[model samples]
Target: MSTGSGAPSAPAPNSHHDTVSDDATATASARGTTPGIAAGPAAPPRKGTFSSLRIRNYRLFATGQMVSNTGTWMQRIAQDWLVLSLTGSSAAVGITTALQFLPMLLFGLYGGVIADRFPKRKLLLLTQSAMGLTGLTLAGLTLSGQVEVWHVYLVALLLGLATVVDNPARQAFVSEMVGQDDLRNAVSLNSANFQSARLIGPAVAGVLITAFGSGWAFLFNGLSFIAPLTGLLMMRTAELHKVDRVPRSKGQLREGLRYVSQRPDLIWPIVLVGFIGTFGFNFPIWLTAFVYHVFHQGAGTYALFNGLMAAGSLIGALLAARRAGSRLRLLVGAAMLFGALEITAALAPSFWLFAALLAPIGMVGLTINVTANSSVQMATDPLMRGRVMSLFMMVFMGGTPLGAPVVGWVTDAFGARIGFLAGGVISLTAAGLIGLVLARVGGLRLKIDLRRGHQHLTFVPRAPGAAAPSGEKALAPAA
Candidate 1:
């Protein structure tokens, strides 16, 4: 649901009173109403990733995003391909990629602060409209056959600036749509939706580029933004959940850094994601180069590689959706597996074999991504979620600006093979280090403790960061 500039009021206790089930348990629970539930006699039936669909507003949001995201992917491929066509320098392509993400590195923290201070739906509306205009500008330049590499760069910067606001608004807005109860499921399904679009977007872009021109792809992307804008406008404002907006302290950005530093569990995952984003996940650079240079193929092959990876990613996202709760085990295990698969794919003998390898690579990578995202989002406080997520996204995406050029240079200097191998090694090494760090900090000594279910967990936080516990006294008890 959408809300205006002001914070939405708390939902009324009698909001769902009319829809009671005709059962004794239901009657008991409905005796006195509450905002989330009637005073329940039993816990609600467990729902999975699709739980968000029960809310009509979120369903509309998802549907519109799926359509728009596909076209966005098309523009991304077209932009990269156009740069490569003009310059033939992987370095130039890397620079363009860097420009697109550079804002996340520089402005991401402040973007988070803005998300906290503003109304997300309104913020999204403005950003989305701006992006649409940027896309239109690209289309006009390209379709008229007057586009230049410099124009592309300038347009990319504009779009990137818009994304700085769009990213945080969208991330924080999800929580407001679906309350905390089904948030993990909503997050998983959202991942699945994105991967599903990934599976379609690039392939379609490839065909469109071959048939008409890159300009048409740009035009399609420009038009696509309308879906999201419409969705935002049409949402029911009253149902939105409001978060208390806190004024920023002078060193709030520094405070965010300190908060991350204090949590080994959170810090390590962010570190691991940063490593992967930097080295392991430069698919734009790798796939395009792999097709043109190594395989001596054209745009079709490039699109095929991305599509196969997305196909794998789709399954991975679904599997994550099937799982009920997030687990640190999933994060570490998936990272190791993703790295191993990436290494194997780099060694594949033929183009088809390498393309086939993308599925597993995509699967493991997506699993790690969704699991890490859900864990971090669930762990953070509502008040600080925007800043924390922004930090997470900055580390995850910003590393690309620093690493893309290096990876591009490596691919050019040594070979694509060496570049892939190096990334895989770094990723695996990161996973191992994170596991060890968790063990050391969480006091995990490989001993069993059945009472608290510490088997899967390596480190447990001593207290709630959001709330202070009551006073306690230490005591000795018989074993």
Candidate 2:
């Protein structure tokens, strides 16, 4: 989302790093769509990705979130390692992951309702505090040496319950902070901050896990929550432009479902996200299992791989920030490229070759992510933003809980090679299928409107009287 104070802002704590990674879906919704979407000259001035930071409130929020996100990543590495250590099964790690995200999948629609009904700032305070406490509790149990697998499972489930409400609130809150004008930039910059933290946090976690234990990482993450909470409290609510929360009516959920079903602009991006998410976005499961079991490496290697990917992701996000307008053609093209890159990475024979592939993988993934997000957000009406965004998130993040465990099983049963191959196949298939669906819906016969502004999203069929067949192409005004 917008990681600034009032004019911008925005977790579920699934892992200690849960605070960072899980929130990306919400952040994508916040930025990819809402604000700063416009037609402009190519190559604008070098406004830093963090240009939203020029706003005092947003700067404070971004700084706090950046610090907290680093700690969150540290916790995620530690948590995954701890689970692996305790159960010694990739399946267990996957289950823990599923539990953490299950709430989002099951209750995402309900969560949107909660966000629409509540003031987001106050809601965030509660969720952030609950998440922090969960991390602290896990740390205490682990440090006291009373930790067990069940404890991790329980806490993960609890953190997930909080996420069911928290995720949507945070996504909706970003619109309030930056207004719509700077929302897109703020959102892209926010993703950059997250990936930057990913680049740093995991490498640091690798060192900490190798040197000490998981306990300190959890403790550090628990304490990191204070920074964001303080930032939230310090914000001047009087200056914030809170959105008008409409009272829920009968069949509100169904109405939301119907709203998205009718519009290809909104529905296609979310469906694409689901496909990629289910097949492509199992990095944590794949990477963890590969480094530990396949490559015969340890935590250090795992952290390095993620950090490198984050480096690529940072570059991708920055490039995306420079994109003046959102387009589905660009999104589909990037997704296809991303899937191909992942396939290449999967087939790489050497560890160095595989690691090198992660950079472009990150780049392509971020490109598709930012583009799809901005396209969906900018296209939907403001009244339905929260619900629409939540569904968008459900497709994006919800696929993880459903697919990760299956991917984990495949990796355990077949091999890490097969897992990566399967992921690549799924991603490519999703992109292609979604592209076909969009083309049919938009009545296209191969012509793409990539450079056209967002308003040109509507593509109606040329009428019988509009044109003749042979030599010249028929054109009509966008509805």
Candidate 3:
């Protein structure tokens, strides 16, 4: 079942949410209609990293995402392999990737607007179904020997369009399932779930493509949509926490942008991730180049590199799931480590050492992703979450299309090592610059205390005349 009130309004900027368990629970209690929110009524939620699974709705959602994510990963690998086989040019694979992410760059904001206007549950159902069909169609074409580069390109673009809507709605819907109490845990688990699929999906695709053909892999991907569809159908709608849907209106796109611009915390992290996503995360191109040209190895070595990275990523996500908080410091710290590791790996002398570095790099990269995602979602208003998250997804993912061609050119011209090193330099520089900017805006100054057992470093209050971060209050110095 779907839930939405007509002409819903957003919460005020300074509105108090502490009184409510979260936006959904607050809405439910206010209406006194929805059930399954109170602890007494439901079974005690599971503890630690898997706590979010305690909610029946979330449990079903996670199960579906797990299966669907694996299929999605399979399709990603198979699609690229199919395109490369047909065209025999690495450029063709890049084009396929660009086409898939291009929609997010172009129209992702409007997709968020639509998500805010409709029921997230229903939107997900539609998008998930559409994705499934696209997979099936591609499978049919491949199995029939009718597949072409153009056909793959077109399907990639269609899938990207579906993702533009799916990403934001799917992100915002987590809060609806578990409320704020479990939102952080759920977000971390979602990352873990994807990474776990990353481990399974690519390996499975490699086998399927080699054994039966890429067509069979596509067929499995096409069929994988069943899990998510079934999960959505099985969900008990009444138990879902409510979120106010924004009614259709003009300037919503601008409204979302403006809202983000005014919030320093939101905008800075988004900016930091955007830089990391665009320049630092071009792994497919970089890793492949390293495997063939630098390491003088074949597909097997590349697969090993990817598998180690996925293992690290899985570790990072699970660790994040255990923690209840998301901090900007964690986000900044993880990004720095990620950038530094990339630079180190790029310059490594031995293949074994380089391969070993991949795991830590993947771990830190996942930390950056999961931290940014959870922090952004936790900070945004429930009413504006869809739009805010849309922007987050846009900058984090959509930048790839724009960045990939440039990164590809650099790799082609200067060699893979230089390209990888340059990406790390940019990422590290951006994190440092953004960290300073955040401190300046927040009216915070660094204070170093060298006393034993005391904090070695921290942010201290700025001088009395210093401006506050927002129009709100600032930290005053202790008398």
**Which structure among the candidates has the greatest TM-score?**
3
Cα distance off (Å), candidate 3, residue 149: 2.2
Which should have the higher TM-score, number 2 or number 3? 3
Query: lDDT per prediction?
Result: 0.74, 0.73, 0.78
Residue 386 error, candidate 2, Å: 1.5
lDDT of 2 by residue, 377-461 (tens): 6555556767777787777877778998998899889888888889998888888887766655444434346575644343333
Locate the minimum summed-lDDT window of 10 residues in model 2: 470-479
Give candidate 3's total backbone clashes: 0
Cα lDDT for residue 436, candidate 3:
68
Q: What are the per-residue Cα lDDT tens digits for candidate 1 across 1-479?
A: 11111112222211312233446334543554321122322422456546678987788789888988898888988888888888876767777888788899899888888887788899999999999999899999999999999999888878878888788788878888887776776777788888898889899999998888899889999999999899999999888887777585687777667766655446777888988888888888877778878898877777788889999988988787667555565687888888888788878888778988999999999888887787667656677777778888888888888988888888778777777788888888888777665544432333436765457433332332211111100000000
What's the true lDDT of residue 216 in model 1?
89
The segments of candidate 1 whose C-alpha lies over 4 angstroms from its true place after superposition are 1-46, 445-479
Candidate 1 clashing pairs?
none
TM-score for predicted model 2 compared with the true structure: 0.84
Clashing residue pair totals per candidate (backbone < 3 A): 0, 17, 0
